[model samples]
Target: MSASPLLDQLIEALRCLPGVGQKSAQRMAYHLLERDREGGVRLAARLAEAMEKIGHCERCRDFSEVPVCPLCASPARETQLLCVVETPADRLAIELATGYRGLYFVLQGRLSPLDGIGPRELGLDLLAARLAAGDVGELIIATNPTVEGEATAHYLAQLARQHGVRPSRLAHGLPLGGELEYIDRGTLAHAFGSRSEIPS
Candidate 1:
């Protein structure tokens, strides 16, 4: 432990961040104290303010300072297409990588019974309500290609069908420009199974 109790507490606090171990936390604490005290103060203030003010968006459930996020508030976004993502990060990834102009419904997490994350935990009820409103024609399931994600996708598809909304999954297969030999067996198998005919 450090000589200063506050410093030790700071190191422990830094360790709370994802992938940050004891050594990394200690290093960060030392750097903040020695080299970047002003930066550290700014970081602390902003972090505190964010924790206090940032909340989930009412419509999309993404982190927002306001009730409805800017994207959901925008009238230009396609109301007929509602993309379902596992997290705000995933939504951001889609927004950055694709030309998708549709709205979103952030699940926050996939259905993991063992972890105590279920339909209610992921806000599926809210999504169901939105689907039932009949504005969304398509529910784009953009969950990750994991076992839990697949289960979550299946559940979402059922929910969409119940509401008469067409459900579509993000095509999972091979990455562009990647060689077949370098790809994993599961990916290769999936790609082969999902092979589509070349458009004339």
Candidate 2:
């Protein structure tokens, strides 16, 4: 039997989340209704609040309520050292694993021509502008080891060279095709410690 209109809408809305299938959505909907209406209401309110308030940081492209993220606004961070990564989560992982004091540029995604995600889509123009300002002396690429990530890293390395900024890549201790967020802290620390310069 088809679900009631409200139930159907709730299930569909839940499915909008990544990796949440119909069954999972249905289960979540039911669980929320059955055991935790208060939590469900809070979740809905928080989602709405986040959607209304959270936006990409002007400088780093990471999620932030203000125009600039805390990292970009911080005075202690090394502004001359820049690290590029696929997402904000990767940046957080790096922060947790290593003592990297550099500033970061979050791509929000990697190069994927088939998906129509090119340089513009990944905010490379904004990054290019930052590099052209000549503040960044060295760029460290910490994108995942996936094929698309590799392509993005190479492209950014070229862009850095064009702006006279040295480019480096995280070491190979991170397995091929592995995401930075999933790597162990020890491996991530090692990778950051052993990062090598990309040949211009």
Each model's lDDT = 0.95, 0.94
Candidate 2 lDDT by residue in tens digits, 1-200: 35589999999999999999999999999999999999999999999999999999999999999999888999999999999999989999999999999899999999999999999999999999999999999999999988899899999999999999999997678888999999998789978998889999
How far is each candidate from the true structure, as Cα RMSD in Å? Answer: 1.4, 6.6
The alpha-carbon deviation from the true structure for residue 143 of candidate 1, after best TM-score superposition, in angstroms, is 0.8
* Residue 60 alpha-carbon offset, candidate 2, angstroms: 0.6
TM-score of each: 0.94, 0.80
For model 1 the local lDDT of residue 51 reads 97
Candidate 2 local Cα displacement, residue 140, angstroms: 0.3
Any runs in candidate 2 off by more than 4 Å, and if so which? 2-4, 174-200
What is the alpha-carbon lDDT of model 1 when measured against the actual structure?
A: 0.95
Encode model 1's per-residue lDDT on 24-87: one tens digit a residue: 9999999999999999999999999999999999999999999999999999999999999999
Worst 10 residues of 1 by lDDT: 1-10
